[model samples]
Target: MDAMIPLAQFLWLAGALLAAGLATGILAGLFGIGGGAIIVPVLFEVFAAVGVAPELRMHLAVGTSLAIIIPTALRSYAAHRARSAVRADALRRWALPVVLGVVAGTALASVSPDRVLKFAFVAFAALMSGRLLFGRDHWTLGEQLPGRALMSAYGFGVGLSSPLIGISGGGIASVIMTLYRVPIHQAIATSAGLGVLIAIPGALGYVLGGWPHMAELPPLSLGYVSVPGAVLVGSVATLAAPLGARLAHAFTKRQLEVAFGLYLLIVGARFAWQLVA
Candidate 1:
């Protein structure tokens, strides 16, 4: 990929991707997001600048983001685990269903129109922003988490939506945990763990699902996943993840919520603009 790009242009894109990685890592650890909300939009523009077709850019961005999340999510989860913040039991229950969901969603994406994915990204980001920004503590779905069947359903939903939106399942999982009355910090940490589950399979699924389209992708591509995009962003993001986790413990719950909400709002707005324009 670097061989094909002119030195100046390659340097420019590398800097942009590295910068995005820094922010993505921080957001991952700080807010327990997979940072796909950040990566997708940034990569979308990057892919466009690189001459990726309009119809293929979103899928490529999404597939690449999931690949990047693999390492970042693991590092973030480890950092949060050191603080004893993860909900291990919930992760165990969600494991199978979430993987299955990723498989299902990846299959769907292979056949679905690009608009379907772009719309999903916009809608999920908006819904998450609304929940974080305006939701009150009284917004409990129940006193405790639901039964296995319901829990599985939630996990499946997280899995299904995550690949579509290019996230690691953190956004939806954290929201669901909070709705079940889990502490925000714990929910965030657990979501980091859930990200591992979402990212690995999601990335793999995208690669396989996109096999038929390999010829349409940019150079050094593996199916929909861009080798350069993953390496450039994932490497920096992994190193920065621990720092974000440490910072996460320093902020008050409301402060964290507000920051995450505002960030999501900006991302959502950016995509909405793209759709309208």
Candidate 2:
């Protein structure tokens, strides 16, 4: 209880977290991109600035970001479901495998070094961005979505990769879905469902794995999850998400992808700079 006073005193950090939530919430709605791409970078900087040790800083950032995704993803999922955009069949086939990957990825995140994870995030995000910026709709490997085995394999990759960078697995999932001829709207809707799967296990894994080290984290934290940070961020994210959904219908798909791609490039560049500097 007493620990929270310090958080209130840190006006800049509070404000920054709130602002980051607002932006990411809008982005989550606008791009169906999970907003973790932005939140991970923002929280990393905040934790660094607050003097968290390098060892656990990235974990905290990622864990807290996952926590934030819970509400945001569920909200987006419900909204998309109402629109009948969700493809339940594809999700049914991929959910189990993606869950498996989520478990494995969470295990990896619990042990890997910050620099190694950041580098991986940078590389993966850059590739995702490149595909968005330049990849064409018709460039697909097959005429239709893959068989169950192959689809599960791709889901595994998304589940594994997303936790490493604190995302909800939506970005990669949507990209793959769209590439294989899933309509962009359906892809976005399906990814929202995927995000829910990613966030639940991802958040629990961080909390359970890091419980022993909870005391080392920043104020208002439970294990790796920052209570106040997640609450503030989640609140704003939930409020702004509907606005983004409405706005999503206003823009061309290409325009949204381009913006998302540029944003990810910036995220990658920030981490790369941090790595070298």
Per-prediction TM-score, please?
A: 0.84, 0.87
Report the backbone clash tally of model 1: 0
Q: Which stretches of model 2 miss by more than 4 angstroms?
A: 1-13, 26-34, 240-256
**Each prediction's number of clashing residue pairs:** 0, 0
The numbered model that scores best in TM-score is: 2
Cα lDDT of model 2 by residue, 75-159, tens digit? 8899999999999999999899999999999999888788877987898889989998998767887757889989999989989
Q: Candidate 2, residue 182: CA error in Å?
A: 1.3
* TM-score between model 1 and native: 0.84
**Local distance difference test values of all predictions, in order:** 0.85, 0.84
lDDT of 1 by residue, 1-277 (tens): 7665656555666776788778777777788555688789878888888777888999999999999888878988999999999988898899999989988998898788788898898798788889878988787888778989999999999999999988988878887888888887998899999899889988888898788888777766898898878998887777777899899999998899889888888877877877789
